[model samples]
Target: MTSDTVPVPPGGEILRYAAFTTRPDGGNPAGVVLDASGLSTERMLAIAAEVGYSETAFLIPGRAEGTYTVRYFSPLLEVPFCGHATVASAVALAERAGPGHYVFATPAGEVPIEVDKDADGVLRATLTSVEPHVEEAGEADVAEALALLGWSPEDLDAALPPRIAYGGARHLVLAAATRDRLARLAYDFDGLAAYMTARDLVTLQLVWRESEDVFHVRDPFPVGGVVEDPATGAAAAAFGAYLRELGAVTVPATLTLHQGDDLGRPGLLHVELREGDARVRVSGAAVAIP
Candidate 1:
């Protein structure tokens, strides 16, 4: 293998942080390894499993400043991209390098991130996703998803419909007709995992429209070896593309996503869609876990 085959020493530092929310206990927690230059893929995978979060990011510094080669790993396997982990990693970098722009070369593509502090001095990150696109989920796949989720046809929102959305990763978007239906999420984990794996899906984006520009969302991430994800940046980006493509929301719109409230780890995600822009922008504030 390449230099990535070098082993990582035991007791190497790992940083824990939450993304998409300023509070430590609110957003999705991710493990950040800022200096993973000599880490092998196997070592990174083991570290990620030990972290026991939905995802962890490994950073290998590039020759140029503010640029790095990044890799993401779930507890079970390597993923092409991870939104929360990216935000967490960017915030971690900003803490060291000061707030500015950073370029991450991921397996998916080059992801540009902007880091700036809010008026309250809280660091926020905005990641511009790779070119996003939506594909029809098809009748059979939607039916199978509903069956595994223990939901029926009437439970789906007619306006939203079922579709496979992709930003940096692919997610199956299913909108519930009511907030109650979305809140009562009990699913056949093994069955859903199998189905999702077969179709190369990252998570099931379960959503409920709370208002014209606001939504409540949840992510079932059995494939990542997590029961659920409190805040999902990739899914939020895909959802923005889904809305624009389906004409559900007008272009140049900024939508707010409220997630993890049901799990008691409430996080907020801001999604922006510009007119004639295929890529989506997902913004959130992240904080170190103390």
Candidate 2:
């Protein structure tokens, strides 16, 4: 069935916790509904509101063993898919059921997730998204976005032209030319949020590349009722797709994304692009929140 037409369960029954990086206070946070067998849209929305984060993930056991269906939500509303929350939920399940592969059936489409322990025993998860797409932003949209962000066209990096990218959800990717330019982040929340909402955007993926394979990134999630995201996996995955489209990177590549430093909640995201597979792979460690 098409995700657009897929029905949300009546209401979920369990609540679990997942810490995308380390303890609860660090990294990105997400709510995990371990077994959402029968959940309604309104019920899931309420649960997400109570948990209160940029995104929360709900899991349902799938047809096969070791597989599951997953859904993601923000405090404000339901999103098609979420990467950080997916990592969080997978790790949480691994800790309990042991590390393995799980399938997520999201509003956007089917996502494949796998969890395992690293050499240091850090629980990390890798999620492969549905096929990704990128599009150019209209001049008017870019102007409005820049005005809200308090940035002019001069602040942009010509190397990375502005565009809208999609992996799980849609993000407006804007590249900053200088580190200083990316650091000084100030925006009109209301204005930007309204603009994003009208365009069905989840966040503004603001970025600055430090080297060939490393980047510094930030996400303005005004539409999710947050000024900024501490860590963003979904956007990172979308960015990988964007890079491939720009011919900036080749397939079967691994890229590093650093974010949340300005807010003091630093996070690291690893992304992979496989040859012959258009899906983006986002990997990160997740720990329990005490």
Candidate 3:
């Protein structure tokens, strides 16, 4: 029998941290495992389930200098990459190892993360995303998404259109004309999960552009048993690429995305598109939830 057999408990053994916002009540909550060298995949999954967050991060390098390995899992299943967890893990590592750049080899790819102290010396984590790509959402895909979301194309912003965006995971990006439209979200969970599974989607990025550089966003994560994600750095990074590809925004632009207010856990995501690279940069802070 393989060592990846037994499952671990769900919550107490793990640490919880909110990423991308300073307040513990704000930002996206993530599970952080500081040391996971001897832990197998099964053990990690068990720990994640115990942690009970949408995504928990397992940091497996023991020390802080070399490239570390990270694994992300939700209560239900594992994912390729999780931005909030990555940020949380990076910041957690920084607190102990001192702030600096650290490379993470994840299931999705090699993710380079940097943790730095702010003016107040509070450590914040930033992750440079893998090369992201965007694709046109087809008529059938759009219709299916709308049906699952209890929304119609009429509710969509005429200018923004629809697209499947990717950084580490695939997400359908839909724009609402008003924040009110974006706020009131309801969806058929089973149907949405089925549609997402078929398309390999991770979440649905329902957004309302507040200004040229500011946006209000919400995500429905049916595939992972999450009704909604208040703040999603990965989706935000993907959305930045989508905007760039559509000429909606210029490179070297600093984009601000506000998420999770409807859930009362307001989180902020900052996306930067560099002048020469197509990959996006997502920045945020990690706050200890306990």
Please, what is the TM-score per model?
Answer: 0.96, 0.92, 0.94
lDDT of each: 0.93, 0.84, 0.85
> Candidate 2 has which clashing residue pairs, if any?
9-39, 9-40, 10-39, 10-40, 11-39, 11-40, 252-273
Worst 10 residues of 2 by lDDT: 1-10
Candidate 1 vs 3: which has more TM-score: 1
Query: Candidate 2 — what's its lDDT?
Result: 0.84
- Give the best candidate by lDDT: 1
Off by over 4 Å in 2: 1-20
User: In model 3, which regions exceed 4 Å deviation?
Assistant: 1-13, 62-66
lDDT of 2 by residue, 115-209 (tens): 88888888889989888999999999999999999999999999999999999899999999999999999999998889999999999999999
What is the per-residue lDDT of model 3 for residues 1-290, given as tens digits with 9 covering 90 to 100?
12254343332246688988999999889988776767777777776666667888877773557478888887777888888998888887787778999999888888898888989877887898888999999998898888878888889998898999999888899999888889889889898988989999988999999889999999988777789987898898899899999999877799999998999999988999988898888999888887
Error of 2 at 6 (Å): 25
- TM-score (C-alpha, index-matched) for candidate 2: 0.92
**Residue 240 of model 2, lDDT score:** 95
lDDT tens per residue, model 1, 171-215: 999999999999999999999989999999999999999998999
Residue 288 local lDDT, model 1: 97
Residue 125 lDDT, candidate 1, scale 0-100: 99
